[model samples]
Target: MRMKKTTTAAIGAAALLSGLLTLAGAPAAHAADGCNNDNGRTVRTAFGGKGQGFELRVNGSGNSTCAWGRIVGGAPGMHVWVDRSSDGGRTWEPQLGWAEISSGGSIWTEAWRDSNGRLMRACGDSGYNTAITCTTWY
Candidate 1:
């Protein structure tokens, strides 16, 4: 009778520990959720070289906007940037610089505010090549 009780208790403890470990290893929930396009707008543009391309996401809310860039394929040494224009693309802010996507595939994001009635642009360059392509988000 004592052996039976000890075996049952061990099983119960193992089950409880398994449940706790699963919960502890779970991923945390996001705080801001996702970009709310209901009160705002979103645009996606494609750029890059032949087999290697990139997509840009422009999420705009009120006078604020966030831009994100992601590599579509295995593009090595690819770099991109986001530029802001307050005067309907007549002029643009300084190039926000370039970022190379990580090997594990992570997206690059930038945010700016007080850009009401302005425009956002995503540009990309393939390594040392001087040629570039840009897309505007209104």
Candidate 2:
């Protein structure tokens, strides 16, 4: 009947408007801040003198990890590295070093396999020896 047709048209119009509104309000997908990768797992800690810190992230693919370091309060001559582990946190591989002189901050990334589940350890140095700050496992 006429009422049934009008009701169907109203429902269709409402559905179309809802879909349009959802699309209009949607935001574009963006990679994680700093690391430029989709980090599904994250670990953060402080290192060196006060205000210095390190963060490690594992990509969603579980085949890569990224490390970021920052020296707050105007610290200079920063150094960083990421150590990968496959046996939980019991053992860490050799230090995968990162460049220094990043007065503001620095980021580093490396590929890895997730067969045994992966782990990443971040280390930072203001000027002296490097030390572990945080560890992330995925």
Question: Considering every candidate listed, which one attains the maximal TM-score?
Answer: 1
Q: Please report how far candidate 2 places residue 79 from its true position, in Å.
A: 1.0
Measured against the true structure, the TM-scores of the candidates, in listed sequence, are: 0.56, 0.49
The true-structure Cα RMSD of candidate 2 reads 14.0
Instruction: Flag regions of model 1 displaced more than 4 Å.
Output: 1-42, 102-106
Q: Cα deviation in Å at residue 30, candidate 1?
A: 24
TM-score of 2: 0.49
Candidate 1 C-alpha lDDT tens digits along 1-138: 999999999999999999999999763422123443233233666655544555556565564555544455535566666666678777776445357655643345444442457666667666666467666554
The residue pairs found clashing in candidate 2 are: none
Error of 1 at 131 (Å): 1.9
